[model samples]
Target: MYDVETRQRALALVAQGRSLNSVSKQTGISRAAIRSWQARPTPRLRRLAPCARCRPAPGAPDPADSYAYVLGLYLGDGCITRPPQHRTASLRITLDDAWPGVQQEAAAALRAVFPDNAIGWARKVGCHDLKVYSKHLTCLFPQHGPGKKHERPIALEAWQQTIVTAHPWEFIRGLIHSDGSRITNWTEKMSGGQRKRYEYPRYFFTNSSADIIALFTDALDRVGVEWKSAHQSRVARNISVSRKASVALMDLHVGPKH
Candidate 1:
């Protein structure tokens, strides 16, 4: 049997665009063997690379903080689509046009995790979609599946949970960037026979998925940020962080999504 390292070396050579004949001459492996290795399943070949989710003793992705942040963004507003005819799949995250900084950060985060993947930008009606094409996006984000994220179950893998534990703020920031918001509300008060305006700043995270909401709030709880549940409408539920201390904490880490 060919050793694992031998197969990996042959596959890596083929990935580098070397012809099977040349790779065989260089590695002394037969062309048929190299072709068979190349024909192995996607995840089989993907295991040769470092993947926190797929590796035998998987660790956090390098730049695990960035991965945590992007994980939030993915849960909030990202989707992965793989075409039957295409070998590579696409990971896309939607960001509003108003927040250029958040868009740039999302793009940078995607690049940070997938350094070898090509990143692109596509414009939509009111937002821009950051597009990244990779063979390993599924390995990175195992939560990807059919249907709307809110319509299906979403849960973090153990390695992802580890990353979030290490970088809760970045995760919260990403969630806020995608579906949460920081807004100011004002009220009129009569004090000392005069009318005064009191303003309140709070953070709101809305998601249709209760599991996703729980994940956000669980992360908040871990960071000692207090939050409460509120229904903005009949169908929309929001996890609101309005406590003075909680807002302060969120402001320090997440702030406005500008």
Candidate 2:
């Protein structure tokens, strides 16, 4: 009799794209046990009776409960963007520019949602551009004001959609520039003859025009827009400027502003 909870965990790992071997290594269960669990149908236990090695301890936590907690964490804090990669970028929001009550309200809301979380502030040693970086429970939130210099705001949803619509060519060109760079070094000297050095290339551009085109096309398709490949090719090359083309592009770029 295999532990039902263990079987559920194995299934979850498989769903998360882990190889069977990786799952076995992670769970400390044999590959054969994983296979048997996978093969057995739900609501139908195997004919063979209790296997002593496979039995779970009394009061063991249910895998379903664990999975639900993990799902909640993901839904609450996980980034939905594809590839699950991180890029540091600058976010500039002045105390005056944004709504007056937004910051305090947002902070209070976050605390209410994540009771265990803490927030702190720190300043960089020599950097004049960056004023303070906020530390949340598990993530670093960088805040920028008038004087701070940070990465370009490439990931903001509004900016991303703008690049997809109004400035696709510039977006594609920026990606090309990112792909053609070489590695660089960063080193600094500390007090008392101690020095620290780290090798990290400056931000690399992703020459991802094809990716952008695919994304935009998929978005248009979902909205039932009748887009033509020839039009896209011409726009990519900066040659599509007929009146009809202009109207079509305008329609795509700015939908009914209701």
The number of the candidate with the highest TM-score is 1
TM-score of each: 0.79, 0.19
How far residue 138's Cα lies from its native spot in candidate 1, in Å, is: 1.6
Q: Candidate 2's error at 25, in angstroms?
A: 67
lDDT of 2 by residue, 138-257 (tens): 122211223211222212234234333544432222222212122354678675788766553321222224433344344444443444443234223111122344334434443211
Residue 224, model 2: Cα distance from true site in angstroms? 0.9
The Cα RMSD of model 2 versus the native structure comes to: 23.9
List candidate 2 segments past 4 Å from native.
1-88, 91-208, 231-258
Clashing pairs in 1: none
lDDT of each: 0.86, 0.35
lDDT of 1 at 219: 98
Runs in model 1 deviating more than 4 A are 1-49, 232-234
> Distance from true position, residue 52, model 2, in Å?
43
